[model samples]
Target: MALSPKTKYNIKRILPFGVIWLILGALFLTVEHLALGNQKNALNSAIKLQPDVVLFALTGVTIIGLLVGCIEVLVLRPLFDRKNFATKIISKFFIYFFFFLIVILITYPIAASIEMDISIWDQKVRNRYFDFFLSVTNLSAMIQLGFSLIVSLLYSEISNNVGQNVLLNFFTGKYHKPVVENRIFMFVDMKDSTTIAEQLGTEEYFKFLRSYYGAFSNAIVKNHGEVYQYVGDEIVITWTLKNGLRDNNCIQCFFDMKSDLYKKGHMYLKKFNMQPDFKAALHFGQVTTGEIGVLKKDIFFTGDVLNTTARILGLCSTYKEDILLSKALAHKIMLDNNYSFKALGEHRLKGKAAIVEIVSLLKNP
Candidate 1:
């Protein structure tokens, strides 16, 4: 399977670090060869580097660098992406340091085998296995550290770019503009919002509303429902029977929303001593939908269906019902499963010319 968008983005972001590592590895080989006077024989009076020996050493450096690059690109970047900037940076630092420590561990043995003395300058002329390994590992680590710093900086830049693009698109673009068709629209409003606001005060009440709205919105998204608008205490959601409304999924979504609200409401009650209740009205029928407006555009539905949904919501107050659905919606839902609903008979809705059948959703028990 292909990687998720998040994973792909992280891989792209860390690709530069891999390139840097490869470059540094190549440079270390160059510097080492030049410093040793390009000698072919280690036993010669002059430092003689064998072509085969040099090739093998360079190959080892290349492989080590490649491994480091793969780790940085695949493992480190993905882990870092999930965290905040400061945490990500700290994590990258520690991971890179750990890798450097590994390089040191491998280098120490190689340096000892080479018999390279740390105390004197000419004593380092002995081309021992330990010395060769230490030199390459140390240089590779230095190069890796430099690349890590660059990657850390680049990661920040790329993250900012992604964040800005997402915000720009969300605020500006027409999001999932629905096709014009008859469908069910539900508007759920918090009961006694003004009184709750007054009791909780401005800041506390606003926070409560935010949490409540956030939970509901997330539920709507989970149910594959589109939230067209959020007006104060009310959230207007739209779902098509043909496409948007999946009986099992949509019903499950509402249950999930209630569960989320129940948990959150109890938390708020304990913390701020505030009680929040919800009332919803659902109606199904023909409606026109698309992106509307020029300066500040929004995707909206307009028709008798929307009007009827609002009226049904208003009836919640009179009927003492938590949720009220139109006959059309109730009929459709009944086709899927046995959900108890009490019919309220045909009644004239405000602003509606004809009478509409309404039903009260009953507890499953």
Candidate 2:
């Protein structure tokens, strides 16, 4: 069986977590090897440094990393998804640290037994394990381990907060300078946002938007969309031309978002006393992408495609349509019988001399 795009994306996201831990573990091992190479304890017991022991330690750390990454992604993230940044970092750190301690307690004894060529239950191996932890060396090692774990957790938090793609770009300097590329833009805006805001008031409206965005995000992820920005009740999603056109992912994303929102209608009605409706417009063209801002930098996209998409979205109320797409994008998409397209005819978009063709996209009943 083939993996879905969403599943592939998730595995990609979790991979870095494991890699970070593996690197840190190697560094920790190197420091320990150098600092305590064949050193004698207060008991005057000397242990030789063997390749198998080092390999076992690395394997243990790798397993711990993969397990922790899985727990952080599948369990911890969703549990604290709504919490503030500081809260998430602090809470997750302690939780993961506790698990780390448990892993160390179990694995250290086994590692000691391997080095001594004895059963883990042997009295000599038991004494060696306890003595190793009670020593000043273990104190220093624990401090190093704690610091390393905190750093790894921070990376995970920041990656989740800023988005994985954005963080990778920042690290890889992929868009350090402006570069032009063809891309597709989707401007999704909630209908009657002002009315909803006023009806719900400030705090309630903020909560509503959180719920609204959260509900729609899964579909975007499933369809492999990169979120560009969120301004008020409007979210800008962008994709490489190839990614957007593949299997008609761009169009499918909009419909999937609608279905997801509809499924959560009861929750919305109960919480906000209203169900949210939205409109989206899609367009494709060349855009210049680069890092921008001084004190705080971000990957910014600049192009007429974005403005054109927003303008097309503005016409949604006029046409009484929920989803609209440019003729260029519509032509590029490979649609099946599940989708229906209606020609809304070419129209003069705002701040443009040339008329652009537009069409409505609908799900077939």
Candidate 3:
């Protein structure tokens, strides 16, 4: 399970507080030993200090530090995880203020109990102890906050980079290691893609492809479809029949893409004078899917199902169709009010042993 950004940020923020607490606790112990001034034998010197007072002071400092550290690590860190920079800065300020206030409240009584008074004690002694306590607490808080911010920034940058790489690999066919199973395969290929590419020149054509891929990929993912590959101006999308062929989600996804493209394609064409359009083929059956090759690995689907889908795509020009689905898909999905499809009857798909039934969706009923 992924941690929420806020939770991760919070953990990073509080880590410094924990380190500071430990250091301050250790400093308190060392200071107590020195104040007693039994350097000939430090242990003996420590023992000479009123045992009860020594124990109380040490115990108080340790307990306070432990409490503060625990709160920071457990409660504070999680709250700031993944927050925006402005929010994070505000959160840090509040956390520091609260921590400082709590520490002062806890320690002031202990100071009073020891009868440590600025007016009564020598200026050096009073100033030294007061300054030491305040400095240690404040320094610890500041260090922890600074460390947390740096860590959070680094973490965010790293995560963003990783996510970008994953998305890139996904589209580029580098990270596609297909899990073998029976599935419905759909391929959408832009019509006149070569002419569009030729007309636009290389850079603008590549930009158009990226934008087209983005829109199509969004639709596929939204419909729980896995986009397997992009071959030139074509995209291959796959989904399990058990889940994907019901309620016409796959068809709906195409319509959504059409609507999106119709709205955006014109703007692209205005610059390039090349309208974007596509033809799609959907087929269902058993197929083996996996990564192929050793050096240049790629996800591949094997068996007659792939060949037949390709043939159906070839018939798009003959039938004057924009989208084609096999009878198997249309039969399973077109029963409900949400879908309607027109049967084109059985036709001999090239290089196929049997004639395949094809259909085109009319509209969402």
Candidate 4:
């Protein structure tokens, strides 16, 4: 069977470790070559007399890199992410044990193929091979791999701390000043958060929130939404108009978040005695977006659209609805018999003079 796209991508990611292995392997071989210049051993003396030291370093580390790369892509990643605790521990133990043995066996073959040494089976030659394998080459590769691993971890941490797209936008200066852009906004708040916190207590409530938000993360990403802010028990998600309407991503995002939390209901009940339920209000309009703050800068959004969005969210509890949106957003979407929405009539919301036509969205039964 062909490898999956995810596996192919992972293999490409790991292949660059080969360069680190090659550099370390070259340094280790050069040191050994220099040290052997004074060795009394006949085999070491003869091998040091040869001009193939650089050749050996390049070939041997290439093999080590290839093996290590395969081990990471095919074995370690799957083992590390195993959902079952016992299986993860047991599989990792055997995988590492087998990994070291395979790398060692491949080392000498790579050397012989590149150097074309015919006396490779002789006692002196075999001893030298065993000594080199046990002493420097593979050991050097392993040590250099630790450095590569650290770099990879640091890079991932930085990317996560500042979102990948946000970092790119900063460098590109996409929002240097307040610029008007059409955006779709969703203000999602946990239902009865104050009551839930009172029932669960502070510590447990925090844990509950952790699980609750974590569950919705995948849905938001899959639906092309950027989490604009996370306040107390609410998450504000936004998207460009083009992305929001594509495949009905904005609408699908709500259903996906609802389904994600619904699926985790039993787990939440078992641990925390309650699962989080939320209400959301979505609207689409022009908003001014800019980089704001001097102490710790953030890309900020302003204008009446946000206030209108918050007020729409306020109507949820009063109207006893799970999802609500202004007609502004509804009018732009391609409904096409895919969803059901009911007109709630035009009303002047609490903080605004102008009336907004709102609607309640229902899952098509």
Summed backbone clashes in each candidate are: 13, 0, 8, 0
Off by over 4 Å in 3: 1-180
Per-candidate TM vs. native? 0.54, 0.94, 0.54, 0.66
Best prediction by TM-score:
2
Q: Against the true structure, what is every candidate's RMSD?
A: 10.8, 2.0, 12.3, 7.0
Superposed by TM-score, candidate 2 places the C-alpha of residue 308 at a distance from the truth, in angstroms, of 1.1
Q: What is the lDDT of residue 320 in candidate 2?
A: 94
Candidate 2: list runs displaced more than 4 Å: 37-49
Q: Where in model 1 is the C-alpha error above 4 Å?
A: 1-179, 335-338
On the 0 to 100 scale, the lDDT of residue 124 in model 2 is 91
Summarize candidate 3's per-residue lDDT along 137-195 as a digit string, tens digits: 44643454345434443433343333332334444565365555788888899998888
Q: Is candidate 1 or candidate 3 better by lDDT?
A: 3
**Across residues 1-365, which tens digit of lDDT does each residue of candidate 1 receive?**
96743454445544544454556656755765676663443332222344554454455555555565567556665566557867866676666676666764564344343333343223444444345445654565466555645554454445443432232334456345655676767788998998888888898887887778777745765665756667888888766776445544445556667878887867877887875779888878887766666886445667878877888889999999888888877777733344578889998988779989988876674
Cα error, residue 85 of model 2, in Å, equals 3.3
Local distance difference test, each candidate: 0.64, 0.85, 0.65, 0.74
lDDT of 2 by residue, 196-302 (tens): 99999999999999999999778998898999999999999989999999888898899899999999999999888899999999999999999999999899999
